[model samples]
Target chain A: MTMKLWYWPEIQGRGEFIRLALEAAGIAYEDCARVSGADALIADLDARKGRAPFAPPYLDIDGFTIAQVADILLYLGDRHDLAPSRIADRYWVHQLQLTIADLVAEVHNVHHPVAVMDYYDDQKPEAARAARQFREERLPKFLDYFEQAAECNDGPWMIDHRWTYADTSLFQLIEGLRYAFPRRMATLTPDYPALARIHGLVADLPGIRQYLASNRRIAFNEQGIFRHYPELDDE
Target chain B: MTMKLWYWPEIQGRGEFIRLALEAAGIAYEDCARVSGADALIADLDARKGRAPFAPPYLDIDGFTIAQVADILLYLGDRHDLAPSRIADRYWVHQLQLTIADLVAEVHNVHHPVAVMDYYDDQKPEAARAARQFREERLPKFLDYFEQAAECNDGPWMIDHRWTYADTSLFQLIEGLRYAFPRRMATLTPDYPALARIHGLVADLPGIRQYLASNRRIAFNEQGIFRHYPELDDE
Candidate 1:
């Protein structure tokens, strides 16, 4: 049976990370929410119990369900043999994935500074301060960390020449930053040579190449993780 | 050969999760930075080249290293047979661990709201707002989620009569919450009976019980994730 993935019907959101991996591996799965609507997604999530997911972007396989972006990615990696073989190396790959998760959380926080319950407009003033710090401090720190990771091996992927989950995640990170802070990303891109190279390489991958061109790969819009606001994108 | 774990010299920081797991498993590992000083951590971290850990609480087993708290716990769990035998069950345990990590990050943010780089004093106003929201919304949301997770199973553990990594993490979360928000935690404790039971159960594990009583488990302080500020804990 095909696994069911439930996420936002329109934007990629956190689900894109899992979708990209499934696509890259040539795996077959139903994009349940995207195929239907948000109502179906909510119903499916609500139907689950005992061991149900805490939030959305959950994957249903057999009788079990799982959530958390990193958890999903790691589970897929292990099942597909897409992660590192050596235990220690696998640990490192997961470490990178967790760090990526942390970055994604912080990226969301920049807009929802006061609380997730508050709107971007309500927290815009606080977001201005938070975004400045994110653009100045975290973006650079996270980008540099990925840059260093890419440089670990001679080729573009984080682990040796083969593409791992971190490569796809790094690609998303670069893409999100570029979409969210065009001017700032333009200024910062030149510094992270290895990260840029990895991003470019991921785009050139046969599976990623096909997926990006298809309608399945949604556009980066304001509703997505990366939002473009001129004020938030200062160089 | 034994593993080498490096973290802060004092307080049960994020690194303590790794330390607790290692101790519970009766694994022999060196606490490098604790034996040395903070300088050792800086040098070891800085000396790492490409694909290095983003921060501390990294374990070096032979030449390979790993970072990220939940990732570390899961990796060690897998290697040590500290997880459930079934794939789906193990996945649930991981999902729970990631949730704890999420809560841990939120707990840290209550004290550092404006910018992680900015001083605590500089971010007091923002932190106060954040703490209010966190206490009112986030803490219960997280605690309720964990309570549900614990209640899913029949026993005290997250899984079927096994002390998985999630149990250990919840124990740490309780300790951290108690240290950081005593009054708030006291009022909130009765609301999460399952989680409180698991916390109390974890304290009874031979290894964990010994670890808590021993001098190895450092006391929580202002420098750690949980800090007691009378103003921060008021209901």
Candidate 2:
């Protein structure tokens, strides 16, 4: 049976991470939200009786539903060899995934620092403060961490000579960050050679190359987590 | 050899989740920061070669280190039978744990909305705005989700007849939220009877009860994730 993924249809958001992984692995799955409407998405979510996902992008596979981007990736990684075979390597990769998730949350907060419910226009001043800190401290810290992780493995991949979900996700992270903070990312990218190499490698992968060139891949926009607010992007 | 768990010593921060799990499982582990000092904690973190933990509350066990609160709990849960044996059940509980982690992050953000480095006083206006939204929309959504999760399993535990790490973490979440937002939690607690019941069950667990009574269990304070700024709490 094909897997079913549920997420907001309009934005790449967290759902893109899952889409990239599934595409890279050449796994066939249905994007439920894109096929159905937003009402269907809400209805499917509400219909889930118990222990339902707090929010999407949740995946239903093999008679069970799983939520959280990292958790979904972990499940996919284990089944498709997108993670390490050894126990410790798997945990290490998972730790990396969690850190990436943290970065994603912070990126979202850059535009909506004061409150998710409030309009970005209402929180512009707060977002400016948040974005400055994110561009200065948080972005460098995360990029440096990943650069170090890559150095440990002598990699374009997180694990030596092997592309896993971490590599694919890192590719998406750098892409999103670049789009969102082009000026800042341009200034900072030169400092993390290993991350750049991995990003390049992930783009060159056959599955990813095809997926990106095809219409299935969504473009980054202001509505998503990584929004390119000109005022927020700085060197 | 005993496992060495490292975290900031002063607060019952994220480390407490790890501590609670270890104590509940009757596992022996050394609190490295408490034994040493914050300087030692920094040195220990900085000395690590590569692919090191991005932050504290990392556990060193059996020649490998694991970080992230939920990931560490998942590791301990698998080894100690604090989680279910079935694969689906494990994922379900993990999803719950991830949701708890999300709540913990938001709880921290209530006091530090603008930037983590910026003082709370510097961002009071923004925090006030953030807290109002948190208390109104975010908190209830999370609590309702967990309450439903608990209700799904006929609880005193997240899963029927079994207490997993999700239950323990939920216990801590409730305790911390109450500490951080006394007025708000008091008003909200009655609405989530299943969660409150699980919280009580966790407190009464022989391991947790003893841990709480002992000096080892740190008290909640302003320095931690759940800080009680009376201005931030309301009905």
Candidate 3:
């Protein structure tokens, strides 16, 4: 089966979740935009008629395109055995992924509190206040929720003994948080041992290890969602 | 079959989307929190172990609980034929619902830009700035996407000739946007005729018409995600 993933060629952003899943599952898919340039991605997106993606990070499987990180992950989890076998468990995994998506959106809003169209430099004061709330409240709350979810099962994985796409996404979420707010994360990391354990487990996976070391993984930068602005990080 | 929905009893928040679908489909459901109280909803949510909802607006069908507005809608769409019959169309409807959820989050943020936990009075200036950006850029972009989606099919609904859960949710989104940013919506609403048509179509559905007139429909208030703060609305 030929599968193609389209996203911004530069930043990890939301596409990283899809990439991590495909990599962890050992699924073979082409990164379309990365190979063909952003212009190709734009042209491809614009050319589509009905039922197109609202933004980047969409996967074209055989001919069908699936957009939205959680939606794409749901499809991947079901097809590649990244999710559980039971229907309820599968929906549970999707719920966890949706929650993770929520936290990710808030993380982006931390740096772009006032508006996405405006530059971070223009909204530094607002970002500072948002960062304080995110660091003190939102980050810990989301981490605590994930920690509870991880603890629900006997194993370190979010669902059963095996790792699901949620685990992989959670791993990326922790990595992004650490990168964006090192000072605050350093203080909070110790509190989420289950999450940290999952992070380590996902990293240790053969596929993930190979992908992270390879050039496929884009480095998080100011243009991406989890940007490290020192003024926005606090302990 | 017994279905119960748990959300804040007071406000027509995210839960309303689920409520709209259920109502539009003529599916019988108990407004659990509204009937019992907010404490009952809290206790029910807190009682769930492993694979629980992260927040309110979760639907308990039989005994299985489903959370996340989009996930809940997807389930309802399948069970009650509120979505398209085709798998691809169903996923398309889901993608649209998720985008609506994104815009809804932004609308909430417009009122509480700095922090969700903090009072709007404390962050009026930040909210003012956020509202301007939301009104100017994000709002139109989202509406344009939805308009295009609605236009893709030869009907007012998002998918095809028949209305899907996406149509119901889109109706709610337009209502919320109008409530939150009256002047801005007034200026922008005419541009997206497709969305306006969908909004009217969803409202006129027999089930929706009855529900809206019934006491089950919670009135929009300052406490809900969509609030009419005159200061935040501008043309």
- Per-candidate DockQ values are 0.70, 0.83, 0.75
Query: Pairs clashing in candidate 3?
Result: none
* Pairs that clash in candidate 1: none
Docking category of candidate 2:
high
Best by lDDT: 3
lDDT digits (tens) for residues A1-235 of candidate 3 = 7689999999999999999999998999999989999999999999987778989889998789899998888777767899989878887888898999999999998988888788999999988999999999888888889999899888778898898999999999999999999999999989989999999999999999999999999999999999999989988
Over the stretch A1-235, how does candidate 1's per-residue lDDT look in tens digits? 8998889888878888988888877788889877889998888877766887778888888866889999998888888977877766677788888998889989888887777676677777778888999999998998888877767777657886688888888888888888888889889989988888889988988889999999989998877777776777698
The interface RMSD value for candidate 1 stands at: 1.2
lDDT leaderboard ranking: 3, 2, 1
State each model's CA lDDT, in order.
Answer: 0.84, 0.89, 0.90
> What is the CA-based DockQ of model 3?
0.75
lDDT for each residue of candidate 2 in B116-170, tens digit (9 for 90 to 100) = 8788998999899999999999999999998888888854689858788988898
Total clashing pairs for each candidate: 0, 0, 0
Candidate 3: give its CA RMSD in angstroms: 1.5
Clashes of 3: 0
**Per-candidate RMSD, Å:** 1.7, 1.1, 1.5
Assess candidate 1 and give its TM-score to the true structure. Answer: 0.96
Off by over 4 Å in 1: none
